[model samples]
Target: MNMSWKGVMPAMTTKFTDDDRLDLKMFEVNLKAQMKAGVDALILGGSLGEASTLLEEEKSVLTRAAVDMVDGKIPIVVNIAEQATKAAMNAAETAEQDGASGLMILPPMRYKADDRETVTYFQEIAKSTSLPIMIYNNPVDYKIHVTLEMFEELLKYDNIQAVKESTRDTTNITRLINRFGDRLKILGGVDTLALECLVMGADGWVAGLVCAFPEETVAIYRLVKAGRIDEAAAIFRWFLPLLELDINPKLVQNIKLAEVATGIGTENVRAPRLPLAGEERAQVLSIIENGMKTRPKLPDYLNL
Candidate 1:
């Protein structure tokens, strides 16, 4: 699958059973729904996918499962957030070998790599694999900003193809395009800012809430690109409350709760990250339920 790197690509939640094993059954259920809703790609083991908690073997399992299920329909992009340069490189290699079409690489995890270190890390990973890479430039959360200057240096590598723009500043999309032109693709990584990012000419959306609301997410992207601003804005307005859930510290649990409300997944998170409980649970549930109650009848935007 050639990665267009342009469309609604869900940063999917990793489904787990009551025993906390890889719930391939539920995973497949979500994957099929995303594909049916016309997403351009499938992204595995991302922040929303609980990449930090997943074992390396488990990431491989998720990658292979997604690869098998999607067949050749869309690209399966594996996320690599390893702290060590060697480990990140190895993960990139493994993802390619396991049939991933692309990778979303974060700046060195835990340690705040200086600009030089950050560029070197990405450059080395690019050297290790022929698969295309999307640098996850999430400085707000990750602390290591891959600045435009860093990108100027990193662009020499042909495999470093895109950036998952999560800086929370939508203008950075224009900044990247202004600087890099067509040299790099930009995918919106902030869920709340997705529509704005798209309107700003982002190549695509690396969506979080799409784990449960795939159709609505895709609808917004398609309508915006199709020049139906009012229609897209209408759906986005309805989606605003739920989309905001993706920015919270407990976003994984919040999105899983949304998934449960939509009848597509469970709220079972790994240990250290329990399901949203007490007042927090009720508040998130209120948001999810309210959204469900008012879930809009989507137009046939895809056909349009």
Candidate 2:
């Protein structure tokens, strides 16, 4: 990706109402807090925001709220992915108009398509708006794989400048970097492996767990940026358990639960994607407690 960036860009948390509506005011508080922590940018309305579950209007409201809070102080990238090309394009265009610095584009979800169709889907979105684009590549996250060949193909779009590579495959980092050279700004999308990525020639990170732990997340980034990989890895190793939970199928619930525990946001996930069940809830809590014991104490962003 062409966008010049660095430091922690938390995937960010979305606040929800007791009635399950998108909560904009609390969202602003969270955004401003991240900015105050000296984060590089904000990824609003992203996977962590439960984008897939939000109504388009609710998303627009949430987008406008973030842009307003940021007030041009930092970059804000919106995650706009939908099963339909038109929906994705419209959301991207709307975010651009709403003052987002960029849009993170994922493949048109829900249906499988040939490589040609998949490439075209993204190309059309690139053509639809002038917003800077970051190709969201998480094969595991989407139940689909974006190959090196596809990465090469997509790089042809000049504005498709950055990527959030979340496969947790360390070897692919050098491979993608060697192939793309400086043409792409490869961001480590998975939080647990973020330091390893930076050590292996990746730039920046897209982390979901950071929603409740910006201090540690940004601390690791600053360390890595200063070539303090060993120190960064120490903290990352301690925080790995919490970061890994971002991948659990119940990630949304787990994240919300953590937010509630730390007092950053709420545990009120939307309907259809229900909240945690007995065993799942217990397991996720155990993971968080273990992480707290290993990592630094919860930062000011949390209730703890």
TM-score of each: 0.98, 0.91
Local distance difference test scores for all models: 0.92, 0.79
Residue 18 accuracy (lDDT) in model 2: 87
- Local accuracy of candidate 2 as per-residue lDDT tens digits, 152-247: 788888888888887779888898888888888888988777888988888888888888777788878777777777777778888888888887
lDDT of 2 at 133: 87
**C-alpha RMSD values across all candidates:** 0.8, 3.5
- Candidate 1 residue-wise lDDT, 110-151, digit = tens: 898888889999999999999989999988998988899999
RMSD of 2: 3.5
lDDT of 2: 0.79
As a whole number from 0 to 100, the lDDT of residue 222 in candidate 2 is 77
Report the CA-based lDDT of candidate 1 relative to the real structure: 0.92
Per-residue lDDT, model 2, residue 249, is 74
